[model samples]
Target: MSFLKKLKEKISKQTDTVTEKFKHGLEKTRNSFADKVNDLVYRYRKVDEDFFEELEEILIGADVGVSTVMELIDQLKEEVQRRNIQDPKEVQAVISEKLVGIYKGDSEFSNEINMQEDQLTVVLFVGVNGVGKTTTIGKLAHKFKSEGKSVLLAAGDTFRAGAIEQLEVWGDRVGVEVIKQGSGSDPAAVMYDAVQAAKARKVDVLLCDTAGRLQNKVNLMKELEKVKRVIEREVPGAPHEVLLVIDATTGQNGLSQAKTFREATNVTGIVLTKLDGTAKGGIVLAIRNEMDVPVKFVGLGEQMDDLQQFDPEQYVYGLFANLVETEEV
Candidate 1:
């Protein structure tokens, strides 16, 4: 088969079964977003000013950022004019292509964790307390362990009561060792110890959970800096990935949280949690468009395997499965 055909087949297979996580996780978004688009196309058979206006509304309402919506609309206009298309229904495919393009802007798309080949890879988790930060760390540990890599968890979230215990619980569940200190201890100290232990044991990955206190950005920044310094001091060029976890159900508020967290530290990627719980999955587009950070992982369900790497093709197919089928027909 030709490369394009093969690629489409792969994406189709993924949407059919391989990407059931995204398909099921994005069910709410598919229903709401697809319904709105289908309705709009049905209402306006001809592409006109009103169609563009309604399309903008739908995109914005789907939690696509205003800036992203504007850019998309502009691109849509250009595509429509360039293609000389008149049917709004025919524009659906173009819209999907554009949406995916927005996320891929100028750079290669990737969801892979940047792990060191021959050394310990440290991932520092950061976000506000209630955004599933600890849970993400645990889930990631499980994933890394399942991959046959020696994984360790560092309970560096010393500020929250029971934070250390929670990470330890996850460590126990995943059959990995957890390095921790008492609650309210210096988070940097925990990181220091974790790095030393990881190096000593020849661990493959070290997942660190840090305090989620974001009320005071200055304090949080300082604390994170100290932790980062300690990790680098122990192992130069450590903390391979600083992942920012966000609750997908938070809608646009999640975007706001991302902006704040990015300002506080260098966030390499995003982990969107609770994706199955919200109808505002369009926030994914807004996130990549506005924040320019790749979404590393998405939480689809409560199962250990629900946290899958983000795939743009699968995501687009999942979101617009019905629309794509209709277009093919």
Candidate 2:
């Protein structure tokens, strides 16, 4: 069985708290592409320029991004020539092969979060407002705690109202300590407090949630830089991984946000949230194809376990799972 199907079976009995939390994500994606891709398979039976053209339209429409769609189309075209064949049945296999190839290799697909740093593994999550940054941090805390890693959360998003309380609630749910100051307070102070507490608490991982800014790019950059500087002063070259959480439903917009955040804080890896609900799961491919960053995790739902390590094979297969339409030909 596919890992995702197995994953579903494993997580299903666990209840739908996480599923319900992220149901919108999957619903958005399924409604966006699952049915549409099914419709494509229903309509096409041959490999032709017309088929490729329409297929390109479908993929691009689903927010796989332009570069990735072109790469996929080219790979599909080559596969058609390689076998000296034109059957649409072969196209499915070829598409699967091409999609899996996007992972670069098995090494690239490795999900191990190596914390070979000198001290604490600090993960600084950044993205625009509403990318589930705080929620992702909560889930990460829960994941780390499950692994026997004492985790701490920092409400670095002190600018947003209820940001501290939001993280505190997650801390309570996950059974971790969250350090924070009041709203409108400096995020750097909150992070410093969290780091100091984490050091004393001997936490394995420190997940810091930063403020989400809108239109104030200059202020955002300054604030993130300040947070980084403070952590380095206290923790010695800290902020191990600057993880950027992105909503896959945002499509190309997410990729652009990654670029901006990368410029602002040197993003080390990405955490893509809300993939289960968006048809634009293709954005994962787009980001991989276009950006210098690696996707470390994907939030399929809001459950702690839903924040799964990024697996390209599972994602690609899931995307094309409904390839064989059960409609009358």
Q: All models: lDDT?
A: 0.87, 0.75
Q: Which regions of candidate 2 are displaced past 4 Å?
A: 1-42, 105-110, 323-329
Worst ten in a row by lDDT for model 1? 1-10
TM-scores, each model vs. reference? 0.95, 0.85
Residue 85 CA error for candidate 1 (Å)?
0.6
How displaced is residue 157 in candidate 1, in Å?
Answer: 0.7
Q: What TM-score does candidate 2 get on C-alpha atoms?
A: 0.85
Evaluated at residue 257, the lDDT of candidate 2 is: 87
lDDT tens per residue, model 1, 30-95:
899878998999899799999999989888888988999999999999999999999887787788
Tens digits of per-residue lDDT for model 2, 1-329: 43334444554664455444344445565566656655665577777898889888988887778888887899888868988865665565566567768655334444556574445888888988898998899888888888778788888887777888988998899898878787888889888898899888777899999987858888999999999999988887678788889988787889888888878888878899888767667787777777846788888865568887776655654554444222112
Worst 10-residue stretch by lDDT in candidate 2?
A: 320-329
Stretches of model 1 off by over 4 angstroms after superposition: 1-8, 13-16, 327-329
Best by TM-score: 1
